[model samples]
Target: MLAGAARPRMPASAARSRLVEPLSGETRLMLRAAQLYYRLNLTQDQVGERLGVSRFKVGRLLDRALRESAVRIEIVHPAARLVELEDELTDRFGLGGAVVVDVASTGSEQDDELLARERVAGAAAVHLASLQPTGAIGVSWGRTMLEVAAHLRPGWTAATEIVQLNGATSQSARPTRAHEIVERFGATSGAAIRLMAAPAIVGTPGLRDALEQDPSVGETLAAARAAQTAVFSMGVLGPESVHVASGYLGATDLAALGEAGAVGDILGRFVTRAGGIALPSLDRRTIGLPLEELRAKTLTVGVVAGAGRGPIALAALRVGCVRVLVTDEATASWVLDHA
Candidate 1:
């Protein structure tokens, strides 16, 4: 080998002895920036100062790290028992779907109201949206139904119609009590709404006969008869129940109902323990669709909750009043275990 020329290049290991072992300043700064930016949660300027580089360089390094897929983020939801409860309800009731919300035992009044309203509305929206392009959809009124109306979707175009199964009175708070619900259905599906303007309860059986003769109310009642699907809630007897809460029944009226072996009600008509509609005196005056007419529909969904309502729900199921039911977990469990 020549003296000036390298001695035929020592082995590769010998070459390493002449090379630098430490990383370059730029390489070290890039790694330091990555750690500070992601792990330490420092600003670009702060990371740059620690690495003795400009903030611009630190920003570039972060961008590179992200682009190279060096960082990954993930999120997971905590497991809950509500899912199991939902499944149990669907299977037991033979329902197409179900949702059970977690309500605090000592939750505030406002919270409870919000929870009830939200659940009812959510269920209504889903069911209404899934209606066939051409069919009748019947609705009944109560606090829960009112809340459901409040949350109904604003616009729809599914080719349907809204028929009021029950009457709303002139003495009532509003002639359009169920107007929001019908309007929502109409808006979303472009369906016509048939309005029933007769009083839910008239002065007398004679008065009811006179009102039913009105063309407008008669037409709405006819539409209700042809309904293919209906949505309603079970009513409980007494002053604290929804009927009383909605001011449809006064204190004395409720007392009278209790004396008649009325345990619950549906669409303002009282029901017996066996779920048969009672109140021979008031039946003729009641303007809602008949129980048999409702049964004729292809789908009848009844949404109800509360532990005290289990018996009525069971009775409704027994009498073939409700083929599809949407209820809370506690109520659903009680119905399956007890009813």
Candidate 2:
């Protein structure tokens, strides 16, 4: 597991609730407390000093010669040997943390790229599952997040609140990929569901403002904005982007954005090389939390990988849109090259 730098993750909820169920309750409690304090890195106070016995015994256990040597430490090597890459990314960006995945072997360059995306997506899935996140989780829509949500297996993150950070778009008669991604997250985590029933980008700023004030949309937006942790990915400026394929944007719009020096996006809102919105007119009608709102979140994570994304990833890091990142070796190297 790659721990993000500096930012606090949810404490081990599973460990805290456990109890000694056997006759020697005192002995078991002391051992568990010692494990928490020494091996698991919980603070001494978190092991509970109240009443003295737990703390005193735990202190004694910590002083024992074994010092957790009895417990075997196993290093499970991943397909992508990337701890060094992950560490480099975090150190360079001053990120909360980073997860770097090794690509599955493939015969062709195209196949390698596809496998790399899958590997990074899988890593993101594992990291999110590790959070065992409680309370509200805000999510953004795009190919990258879709990849992460698709790879997520059934998990123990029970009864979480998952809200979409952006509105939905429909290309065909089927449900939008954005809705599908958020729904899968809720189902995998066994969380409560709240979906936004609006378009991602409206025709005009007036229409966008009106929809933002509509009670149903407004309430969902408020819940997402108030979320303690959020997971999103940037959409690069291109024809193959999820927005274009999902009918949220057209080629002309992309061309216009490129002409105006747009690089990428957090939700539907676009940013430039310097990372702030480059096109005020387009952003005025975009329906989602603004860049500043996302930047302020401590646990906001960006899960992205692959081509034509390095510039945007760098911009997102520089702008503080995401505190944590899950990526692959190639993309990580590319970002470092430009850094």
- Tell me, by TM-score, which candidate is best: 2
After superposition, which runs of candidate 1 have C-alpha atoms over 4 Å from their true positions?
A: 1-106, 131-133, 154-157, 170-176, 245-247
Per-residue lDDT of candidate 1, residues 1-339 (tens digit): 347765575578866865866666665667778889889999999998988889998999888767765655543343255566567656765655555554545467666655754575576556555544357778887666776666666553354788878876545443436666666666666678876787676657887777776787888888888887787877678666755554566777667667777778777677777677667676676777878788777877787766566667766666676766766656666677765
* lDDT for position 45 in model 2: 67
In order, candidate lDDTs are 0.69, 0.78
**Could you give candidate 2's per-residue lDDT for residues 71-170 as a string of tens digits?**
4455677633478777888899888889877776677877776777777888888888776667888998776777888888987466479998888766
- The C-alpha local distance difference test score for the whole of candidate 2 amounts to 0.78
Give, for candidate 1, the lowest lDDT window spanning 10 residues.
71-80
Model 2 CA deviation exceeding 4 Å by range? 1-81, 171-175
With a 3 Å backbone cut-off (N, CA, C), the pairs that clash in candidate 2 are 4-96, 4-97, 5-96, 80-102
Candidate 2 lDDT trough over 10 residues, lowest sum: 64-73
